[model samples]
Target: MSLSLLTPLGHSNVAELIARRTLTAVFQPIVNFDGGTILGYEGLIRGPAGSALEAPGALFAQAAREGLSVALEHAAARTCVAAFASLGCEGKLFLNFSAEALVALGETRDRTVAWLNEHGLGVDRVVLELTEQCQIADVARFVTAVGALRESGIQFALDDYGTANASMNLWVRLQPDVVKIDRFFIDDIANDPLKFEAVRAMQHFAGASGARLVAEGIENAADLIVVRDMGIALGQGFFIGRPDARASREFAQGAREALDAGHIAVFPGATRTPVAASPSGGMAAAKMIVAAPAVPKSATNNDVLELFNRLPNLHAVAVVEHERPLALINRRSFMDRYALPYHRELFGKRPCMLFANASPVIIEKSMTVEQMAKLLASDDQRYLADGFVITDEERYVGLGTGESLVRAVTEVRIEAARYANPLTFLPGNIPISSHIARLVEHRAEFYACYVDLNHFKPFNDRYGYWQGDEVLKFAAAVLADVCDPTRDFLGHVGGDDFLVLFQSDDWLERAMRALRAVDTGALRFYADEDRAAGGIHGEDRRGNPAFFSFVTMAIGCVRVSPDTRGGLPYGSEEIASVAALAKHRAKQEASGFFVIDLDEGAAQLHLHEAPGAAMPQRASALS
Candidate 1:
């Protein structure tokens, strides 16, 4: 509600205005960005079309100047609720209450309840919004009053967040269900880095405190994306909706399409497919099962000899018994034995399985590329000649040539490791960026999280550079420990910043838990004095005595296309842009908290644990 200049119209006029009941309530829709659906309607009080009190600012200011603010607000609530119900609004009815009236809600709540019932509106449908514009005298009492009203099932929302009236202390005292970020920080958020950071920090604070965040006054598509990327739970402004006496019961098509962009089957005429631009780790295994030539156990030894000559490239042959691999016949071993005097005459007519090696190495078709490397490393001559048999559920599928396996492993490892950081051995910038492109191309849903330290630079300056290296190593280990091995991708985006692309659906909670643990454990790494002081003491670049807080990390998370959330992008570049914004927000907040940018993709969630958590990680492929 925008306030206007104090009216010269006096006390008598304020009283006269309330008696006339010349006010209108227009509702502004608060939308759920994830679904492009209306979460609720906030009732904004406005005066008559062209009167002196047409502006809410003028009406409230004149009333406050006359000590009749509470009386005026009570009247406004009655009028607003009645109009809201009559318009057939479908969501919660959010009514604004002045600080003056909040303290005196004894009769006001009952009167508002009566208006709601009369209009067929339930108390549960009402959300009493208190803005920070008014100086809340006695926060404890205010919190109590708001809490006391909850017994009737009415929820409370704190508005104009970040202002003095809605400070952290107030937030703790009240524990409001929702905090609407002030529009001051939302306007042109995409272009303004500072505002973007502020909004993201607020979003993280809200998530940690268990409050839903609402960004008010999103003006355009870019601003909407910025707010959505910060994972703001709800939004209000011209972009989503506008204030009108008649509130809309449903969202328009354009808004719906934008919100559902990421998961839909067809986007801009392109088919959405599972992200597979280039498979890595476990993902590569699915494509590695090449067909192999096999024959029944009854086939004569002559059949094997003839097969080798027919397909010269055949590395080895699997002797099959009832569709299961019974043994492997090495071309050289079989041919060498036959070359010895009369060997072919003695065995050429016998069953091939009888002469074949019975204990050849075998691997599952689903085994990861990394796992394959390990299995292949376990043997030499036996596997070298006979190669390895690929199976599906114990049934023979194909043969993996030793040379092919070695080449494949080397190529996969090289591709994955080339851009890895030397110190931590985590995939570096280039690979992370490429992975994002793969996500967009495949239309796979994954969480891309950017992680970094808060006070590392200062701590390093205070101590030595090597200490910083130890800290980086520790962080890398912790990340490896927490992230799912088979599904998640971890990369070192240079000093202090890392990226984790999560293939699981419940990554938000997992990310939160893991980072929280890191923050708790990181404290001991500091010097004795710094540990006691809660942070390192050092000189700033400008030579000032800077007290650096204990190391805390920030994780900025954004979900990639998998469920067609409107947060959908043309490619990795857009997601990177958003991640950069999220990273900035995380650094500013620096609480070792996870800030997830949520969209409709959250609805299609199916969290899967990553494969091979216990196995040692193969640090990036080749580099």
Candidate 2:
């Protein structure tokens, strides 16, 4: 409700309300995902009924204008505590307070403790949520007050984090025990990659700071499941339990069932192609749909012919029954059959099913164009000529042609390839980062291999870039050949740098095989004399003659195990840095292969020789 819609009630109304202490408190349950149980209740305040200030927005606005915000909060706190104690609600009671009000609460600490004792509530059960409504002008004073309050067994929570005033600086200064993520980032997080990443970053920060995270405004089961699987501590929204006069003791049946489900929700992966104009993955089948007329299954061939005649550009007409598509009749084929000798009179009046293809391809409007591309290779070529029926929940909506599907699929590929290395046609940095994120979300053990060419610049100067390009392609091909198609991903991080996320158990063997291939094949790119001499003379950076050897491969591997995560969330950027650091060490080794046991909290380095398993060479150089 808009505060502007309320009448201008002077300080008299606010003073009267505070004197009567008539504010009502409603409690919303916050669920802890670990046990699928309520962790606490956030007490929300309401104004008097049938009045202009009944809505909280209007009530707060009036209080702020009348300069009675602190007084009003004190009254609201008392009402909430009294109601919560009387209703016998379990867990902590979270009371919202602005910075100014919190300072006042600290000053009245003894009186507040006495009142809580009288109401059968303990000071330890109260968590004060610092709201963003008021600003903190005195950092030192506010911090001191917050510290004093916590000394009395009170907990502080940074509310609406990511919005005004609830920033990282404040969080650090206050060292809040809890941080409630703003609803803006929580809503639709299952489908929005940006929001998902934002929340993930916040989760990482919380982990490092020893602060628990509560995702707010999770209004659907998909979002709830996503928040739960992402390892967020607590969840709160209308779907969990709406704010009511009587606090809920348990979850509703649907929410309980969802929380108890065994499987994790499949979060929508980040689209390979980032299209600014379209946020719906830019490949929905609906985008390529052609609004065409449909004919009932009982309609005669004559009726189909009439539609074709009236709309000469029509390619095919869908045969539907009760709005469900059953078949499609091609325009050209029907016309040709009608043109045959006496065929028009014989079959034109018969059911359109006589000329219809009963096994027409049906696609849902929500299917991605990439999914529809598979039909092009299917054995049935009928879709090419007769087109396909588009539906929403099995009901006919429109039709799509093979031409449009092909075009959309081609566009998606072209856009996606925009991020690929032009020379090697391998995925570039964006996709590499995306894949790392996916692996982290899966919470499974995997190996990250960072591949780079040793001394490539000197080779490029002597052999020219044409040969350099060939060498890069050769490296790509070697990596691709050894990768398990279903378990591994290969990406080129520009120039001679590449990243391989290996899920295969024989990742060590595969890395060794690639190294051997490079050791043997890389020499071919050099001239016969250079190959014989095992080196080439090139100008050094100081204009001095230097001997540059042929380019060799360096492989750095990091074992990312969930068990060793230490309950600390790892972002893709941080993981990539670890892999890169390992690669830097690999470049220092004689064998050009270094393995880091990140899972053991020890960056142990291992070196492997061809045709043998990895053997420990030395301790990790990393600190």
RMSD of each: 27.1, 17.8
- Candidate 1 lDDT (Cα, 0 to 1): 0.69
lDDT of 2: 0.79
Model 1 misplaced regions, further than 4 Å? 1-11, 107-112, 252-254, 263-623
Separately for all candidates shown, the number of backbone clashes (residues 3 or more apart, or on different chains) is 21, 0
lDDT of 2 by residue, 1-623 (tens): 11121224345777688667678899999999888889999999889988998888999888878877777777778788889999998899999998988877776677777778888898889999999774897877787778888998989899999887789988888888999999998999877755776787899999999999999998888788778878897989988899988997976666777677544443434222233112333336888789998998889999998999999989999999999998999999989989999988898789999988998999999676546777877898888778899998899999989888777766765665555666666666766776777777767678888898987888888889998899998999999888864457787877788888887778899999999999788999988999999878898878888998888999988888776658565777666766776787898999999988664323332224234767443222211
Instruction: Highest TM-score: give the candidate number.
Output: 2
